[model samples]
Structure formats: structure tokens, C-alpha cells
Target: MSSPQPPPHSSPTQGAPPQLEQLFHSYGAKIYGLALRCGLAPKDAEDGVQEVFLKVQRRLGTFRGEAALSTWLYQVALNTLRDHRRRVVRQTRATEMSTLSPQAADPHFVAPGQSPVEQASVEERRQIVRLALDRLPHKFREVLILRELQGLSYRDVARILQIRQGTVESRIYRARERMAKELKKLGVEG
Candidate 1:
């Protein structure tokens, strides 16, 4: 499918929501990935994507085109996920920790070659990092996930999070320091 073009002026040309299928085709995977990286279970991630698109369907006409569509969609997705988190009781860390598996490993961290023992060791480190990340405050975690894990530019993260670029950078720096402290508590050195 061809990409959905932004309207020349703010809002859709005729106050119409873009076709749901077109929007989903263009962004579903990215939204799902963001949900998963934010610590949602696979099923929850899928559901979150649906919820985000539902919002888009309902409110796309309200979008002013001041930001890129992806940015606006991300803002909606984060708000949806935040609301969901507040509505649902959280799982204990032990239960949540067990949910991480090899399939969920970040591709960016994969090594081309490793002995079985080394692979197991690497996986252990990843689990530790996940635990450390989960311990971070919401604001810090959001920046790290967007900037470091999702590999978004500082500018894009500021737009999505609705914060200044300097705020994003400072939060990331603080997040790294806190992550280091958490890892140290778990006996992993930086």
C-alpha cells in the first residue's frame, strides 16, 4: 500500500480519519514493538496495538499535523498503555522476570558467535539488565527505551514524550547512572 500522505494543512483535508487499514499496515508492527519493549506481555502488546489504532480511528480528525503521524501515534499509544497500567494490577517482579525468554532478546545485542556457556552467560546478563530497567522510574525508563533501546533520535523522543530535547538527554544520563547502580547491586559491572 502507498503511504498515507499528510494533509497539506492541519487536520485531514475533510475531517476524515485516514483509512484504518492503511494506518495499521504502516505502523502496527512498530507500535507492537514499542508495547513489548515497555514490558508488556506478547498478548498484551497485541491488545495495546489494537487499542492504539482504535484511538487513532476515533481521534485522527483531531490530529493537527503539528507532529509527524508516527509521533502522534506514539503519544496515543503511550497514553493508552499508561492508562492500562494504572487500571490493571501489576505482576510481581519474580513472575515478570520469568516472562523474559531467548526469543525476546534484543537483536542489537546478539553476538555472531558464542559457545553455549557464553550464550547462557550473555542471557543472564540480559535478564539482569531487564530487572534493572524495570526498577527505573517511569520517566527515566521512557527515555532510555525510546533513545537507547528503540534507537530513536533525541529529537524524535522529545516529540513523542512531549519534553524538551535537553530533558531527554538529562533523563537518559540519569537513567544510565541508575541502571549502573542497579546492575552493581546484582553483581554485574559496567
Candidate 2:
């Protein structure tokens, strides 16, 4: 699902108390997008978003503003989604969590000016890249999503993943290499 339209007024600053509904309206799409990129099936990603908001509701009082609200939100989402994946995997021992649902394709990933055949080709490649991303290890996927897809800086990614900046850099580099390998296996050029 696409993100909800942002609230009409200015969002609360980082230090302010998180208005749960407002935050959901403001950032739910972002969180959902993150879940999708992290390889959660679309249905699971939706459920994961709900779970993240529920955790936020319970812990909102504890937010100390030590980090940006967005950062804390991402941390909560990643942890919640990770736990959710583990539970699902344990429940269904043979299920593959990395399979991309057909519905999971983001229409926005398609560029505007391409011809129909070109668009189809581009989307095919996008799906292949997403599949490669899904196949990545969680450590690699997390860093790549945060640094590349979410466009966070190395320091911010380090903060979100609670790793050293150097580690984030290294993970991103390795993730890219792994992704290239995966795409090549799928017949996509670098």
C-alpha cells in the first residue's frame, strides 16, 4: 500500500511527544515501505506495521528524545519485523520468507517517460533487484535498505542499527557486492 497523505500542518519536531495517530498517519507508509524492502510479504508487512504502532503506543512514554524520533521509530520497526519473521519461520518451518509477493511490487519504482515495453522491462529488473534484496542476509539487507533505499547517511544508519559507522560502511559495500552477484544470477547486468 502507498503512504497516507501527510498531515496538513507541520509535523512535531524530534523532541516532542509522539502523537500516535499522527505519527502513524505521517510515517506509517515509510515504515511499511521499510518492511517491504526488508523482505516481509505484503500481508506480513501490513501486520508488522500494526505491531510496530502497538509497540509505539506502549512505549511512547519512555521516549527520551536521545535520538531523532524517526530513528527510534525505525529501530522499533526493524526489531518488531525481525521478531515477527522469526515467529513465522518457527511456526512454518518450510516456508521461505524471502519470496516476493506479486502484489509487493511498487508502482512508483517505474519511471515516467518509458515506453510500455521499456516500462515492463524496467519493472522486471526492479523485481529482480528486489528478489536479490530479499535473498540477502538480514544484516546485509538492513544496512542496504537503510543506507540506499531509505537514503540515510552512514552515521544515521549506524545509529539506527546500533553499529559503528565503519561497520555500516563495510556492510553496505558487501551488501552491494552480494546484490550484484544475485542480480547476475538472475541475468540482470550490473
Candidate 3:
């Protein structure tokens, strides 16, 4: 018998092996939208997307092709988002628990706009929206983001979040009620 041939190293681009560029092209917008809904700043969301793709690149060979490509991508994106959110929460808690204060103000606080009044109003609205979102429990907030912001179908949200469709619907309803209450407090009835 001829000498045993070693198994070929899987080439990165052979026959739909989930190339990094293709993955980004297909899922970039969804991942970014998810990151935004995760309450990350725009820059942080961008970085999260990049970091997610890096993980995808590293883990591509391990994908078994059992699920749809989109499903796998969403799973990766969700994991990355959770990791980033955990890091941010830890950092925030640490800062809140710290006594040391820097002399200089944080540059991230600067508002962008024309007049001070306009900027103030914009900032106020943003604050109100954020407060409303914060008032929601995690399950509710997630359903609202997936349904309203991300425009996911209830079925899709259920699938992605591993919840029953009825649960998704109920959580979304509760989230809307909580958001309305918060908005009413902010003098924005609707």
C-alpha cells in the first residue's frame, strides 16, 4: 500500500467555508443593529462588530453547518454583545464604586449641535428615551429592541432568543407599557 496521505488542511475559501469578508457582507448591518440595541455607543457598537468578526474568523473551522449560516452568525454576534456588555457593566460599577475623581471632564459628554437650546432639548429627549429603556426589565427591553428597533418578526425573535412566541409577545406588550409610563413622566404622552 502507498504511504498514508495526511489529511489536507482545510483551506479557508474552499466551497463556502464561511469566508470572513462574506460573513461581514451578509451580517454586518444586523450585528451592528443588535449592538446598538444592546445599549452600546456607536463607537462601541462598531468595535463590538469588529471584535465579533475576529472571533468568527478564529472559530470558522469549528462550525458544523448544522444550523443556517445566519443563525450561527447571530449566535456569535449575541455572545460577543454579551461579553462587551459585561465588560462595560463591570467598568461602570467599578467607576461608581471608586472615590477618585479626575480633574478634567470626560470629553464624551460634549453634545453636538447648533445652538445651546437645541442641543439641550436634544440631550433631554435622549435622556428621557434612555430612562424609558432603562426602566424596562431585561426580558422586556430585549423584546422591544428585537421587535421595534431591529424589526424582527416575533417568530424570529423567539427563535433567536430561545423563547416561546407568546412570551415574546407578552414581554413586548409589557415593555411598551413601561416605556409609555416613563415617557408620560417626561411629559411626552403618546
* Clash pairs, model 2 backbone: none
- Comparing candidate 1 with candidate 3, which one achieves the higher TM-score? 1
Best by lDDT: 2
- Count the clashes in each prediction: 0, 0, 0
Q: Is candidate 2 or candidate 3 better by lDDT?
A: 2
Candidate 2 per-residue lDDT, tens place, 53-90, comes to: 99988888888999999989888988998898666556
Residue 39 lDDT, candidate 1, scale 0-100:
74
Candidate 1 per-residue C-alpha lDDT over 1-190 given as tens digits, one digit per residue, 9 for 90 to 100: 8999876645544633457778888888888888877776676677778788888888988999999998998899888876654433244343554443223455346577877778778888877887787788889888888888789999999999999999888889998999899989989988
Tell me, by TM-score, which candidate is best. Answer: 1
Residues 61-110, candidate 3: write the lDDT tens digits. Answer: 88888766776777788778878866765776888742111111222465
- Candidate 1: residue pairs that collide: none
User: Candidate 1 regions off by >4 Å?
Assistant: 1-18, 85-103, 106-112
- Residue 128 CA displacement from its true place in model 1, Å: 0.8
Which candidate model has the greater TM-score, 2 or 3? 2
Q: How far is candidate 3 from the true structure (C-alpha RMSD, Å)?
A: 8.7
